[model samples]
Target: PNLLPEQVTGTRIVSQGRRESDYNLIGLTDPRGNKYYWIGPQHEGELLRHDDTDYHAIGDGAVSVTPLHVDLTHEGALKSLREAFG
Candidate 1:
């Protein structure tokens, strides 16, 4: 087809290492002035600092994709909380 399907968001099912590579491949800036990349899948809870750069597989019959934003604002909430508490 010459035109792309409306249901397709251009996203594909990627695997380990590949996902990480894609995540860190390049920085993509969105319309909201936020830059981000694919960072594997984050099903629940926040990602641990040590595990942030790791990739995981979803074998639970569910497809979860994590889009990690490349912006200082990512830690804005934590930074502000620390300042407020201190």
Candidate 2:
């Protein structure tokens, strides 16, 4: 998942083996300074299941590329702020 410059500074990832802490996984910066995060495949299953074939491909040493887009708006918070200020 790609994040806008404002949202990129304080992002966190909480998963098994990874503590719930700030993660600086930003890939690169363009001329405009947008930040990109390479979030791996989204899948369901503790162990490898047939439906997780795409994720499995990575485990087998195959190169995988998943594209993503950036959405900067925090919808729920934005709505609350709008109501409060309006």
Candidate 3:
């Protein structure tokens, strides 16, 4: 099937795994004196951060394809770790 640019648009793939923490913890105590901590994902730069997926998916009207598996390993440290601990 033939497709046109106007009909189907390809968008930039937004990379995930932002090292910068984007969550917050709310500490509270119940009536029974039991302390509890609630962790939730904050709406941090949802549509403003360039590397964020929502930025392109929601802001831009295009197909946003996110990889199922992304390698977040620090390749630069591999050589040093190998030499030191090999």
Candidate 4:
């Protein structure tokens, strides 16, 4: 397959871990217990403010996006099994 310009011109990433605490800014919690962050664009300037609050900002404002996956199979398994039983 041919590579798109955007895909070819993005910054490379190395995953350290998935927990929100691993990378403070990458995953943050707000006062209301809601998480808000950029999937592929974060200002370098705001990186410093991560420690001030639970709010996190991730994915350097680059040309690419990396998706984080959390396993929901355990929770969904019962539903899946029920559906299969029918």
Candidate 5:
């Protein structure tokens, strides 16, 4: 989805990291007809941060393929807590 400056007039997602406010391109495609959501901050600096696990491999000139998981919670911790409580 293309976000225009006029479209995000009152939203907090406006580009504040750049010198001039401009919309950055972000896209997602579902080739297999599965539902997915892609949410993250856009790169706005001259040098990319190495701490981002999502796109760090891409920054190093390597092909990155990240597998998506339905649940994002820490399952190990959850299982331990469940066993302790019950």
Candidate 6:
């Protein structure tokens, strides 16, 4: 594929050390399965805020793969909390 897929923990938009926003916007898919996004105010949204993520993974010419787990519970926290309050 022309667009190489890169895995990222999350996506975000930043102006500096200060984060401007999480990755917002959507991409359009053509009949040929090519994806593209239009720059507009309407496309922005509050989506993600995961730190330790690199924008280059999902930037202009790259594809991003964010692997998510089905179980969202923190195992260590769950165990400790159970023991403390059980």
The lDDT per prediction is: 0.44, 0.47, 0.63, 0.44, 0.47, 0.51
TM-score each candidate: 0.18, 0.30, 0.41, 0.20, 0.24, 0.24
> 1-86, model 6: which lDDT tens digit per residue?
14434533343443221234445477899999999986555634443434434344444343344454488899999999999999
lDDT of 5 by residue, 21-60 (tens): 2345555669987766655445443543344343444344
Which is the leading candidate under TM-score?
A: 3
Per-residue lDDT value at 11 in model 5 = 19
Between prediction 2 and prediction 6, which has the larger lDDT?
6
Segments in model 6 whose C-alpha atoms lie over 4 Å from true places: 1-41, 44-69
Q: What is the lDDT of residue 59 in candidate 5?
A: 43
Residues 1-62, candidate 4: write the lDDT tens digits: 13555544444343322232233346777999999874543433333333222122223323
Local accuracy of candidate 3 as per-residue lDDT tens digits, 1-86: 03456754556676643435468898999999999998976655443456557445534555666677769888889988999999
Winner on TM-score (4 vs 5): 5
Better of 5 and 6 by lDDT: 6
TM-score, model 2 to reference: 0.30
Global fold similarity of model 1 (TM-score): 0.18
- Between candidates 1 and 2, which one is better according to lDDT? 2
RMSD of each: 13.9, 15.9, 7.5, 13.0, 16.2, 11.9
Ten-residue stretch with the least lDDT total in model 2: 11-20
- With a 3 Å backbone cut-off (N, CA, C), the pairs that clash in candidate 2 are none
Candidate 4, run of 10 with poorest lDDT: 49-58
Root-mean-square deviation of candidate 1: 13.9
How accurate locally is residue 59 in candidate 3, as Cα lDDT from 0 to 100? 47
lDDT of 2 by residue, 8-79 (tens): 333222221211333344477677998767554343325432323434443434333444468999999999
lDDT of candidate 3 at residue 83, scale 0 to 100: 90
Worst 10 residues of 6 by lDDT: 10-19
The predicted structure with the larger TM-score, 2 or 5, is 2
